[model samples]
Target: MLTRKQHELVCFINDRLAQTGVSPSFEEMKEALDLKSKSGVHRLISALEERQFIRRLPNRARALEVLRMPERPEKKAPSKVVSPQLRQLPAPANDVIEIPLHGRIAAGVPIEAFEGVSTLAVPAALLGQGDHYALEVAGDSMVEAGILDGDYALVKRQEVARDGEIVVALIDDAEATLKYFRREGAMVRLDPANRAYDPQRYLPAQVRIQGKLSGILRRYH
Candidate 1:
């Protein structure tokens, strides 16, 4: 079985490749993983290459390739653990926008938006520095969050989120949920705009903040 850190590294490398059509440099990996030395990242990459999970070309830049998928472990019977929420489906190309669907939303009870069903074209300037994704809101759960349904949200790809800020969160790796972010110690909460759906509370470990909601673009049909 792969170590937790190895698993996280694999996921991060794959996600970056899928988003940017290229693997990150050793320095990028070092910064992303907070490693003190490039050798640390190199070791991890070497391990992944040896396991056939990734391929690396010698002396070439951005030449890593995903070879085989990691094996999923067998679930124990009567497992209470829930799956992690996936942020968005892999885009066909790095240049295309992949918006989260959240799920089937309604005019009444606010449901979280699904991930990666809708998309829009946006100039890189609108995304600011180091930003790469834009998600389309599918429900009004965030109307109170200052976001409306059918709005295109310009997002800055990030791992950490600040309090009282809007964010796209994965609720169990199955749904891409939207809410105002709040955190206290080891706990994180998703504050909804509508009253029908209660705010979601999660351990910091269970929730993954995909990105911060930078700006919104809306259109009426």
Candidate 2:
């Protein structure tokens, strides 16, 4: 059996090859896997080749091909037990929901914002029903939250959010940013997950809650 990292590396390379008809560059693989250097990528590639999952073309650059893909495991029956909290939540419908993928949102300093670059189709079960949208994260301020540069944040559109919930906070009606939201009387505090960033506080009137975070998606390639 492939190790977890090896499995991920093979899947990523396979995805890129299938989508773009070419292997991803060393730099691309390095970034996708969060590897420190291209050497790490090389090792993974060697392992994949030894396992007969992939092959490299001779005398060619970016010439990798997938020989076989791992078979997906069979789906098991649903469990009978459901938590009380989960039972209160509605089950998602059996249909794909298309959500608008808004342009990048700043995770560090607030930035000028735009919306509706494209739409992404996701299963409704993944995100609870609401006016949901997505934003491509652009900064590393939320790295400690497992959110990284280039990650996509799935958000549920709402004007209000509970304290400690990660939110898209628009400051002074001019800039949009993402952070954990906290309320202190009439003031609002936006806290970044990274210790490197100090929390930002502002008046409630100056900040608008655009959305509350629902989930995150990271594409390796």
TM-score of each: 0.46, 0.57
Model 2: weakest 10-residue lDDT segment is 77-86
- Candidate 2, overall lDDT? 0.75
Q: Weakest 10 consecutive residues, lDDT, candidate 1?
A: 77-86
How many residue pairs collide in each prediction? 18, 0
TM-score of 2: 0.57
lDDT for each residue of candidate 1 in 1-221, tens digit (9 for 90 to 100): 23334556787788898999888888888888888999777767765664467888779877888776554434231121111211221222235344433333322233454533555565332444565566656666655334567666666778888786667776666456767788866888877655545777888777787787665555656
Q: How high is the CA lDDT of each candidate model?
A: 0.60, 0.75
lDDT of 2 by residue, 1-221 (tens): 24335666778888897898888999999999899999878877875675578899999998998888765322331222111111222344477788898899999989876554798776666577678998888998876555788877888899999876789988888789999888887889998756668889998889999998876766766
Model 1: lDDT to the true structure? 0.60
Q: After superposing candidate 1 on the true structure, give the runs of residues whose Cα lies further than 4 Å from its correct spot.
A: 1-119, 123-125
User: Cα miss at 207, model 2 (Å)?
Assistant: 0.3
On TM-score, the candidate that comes out on top is: 2
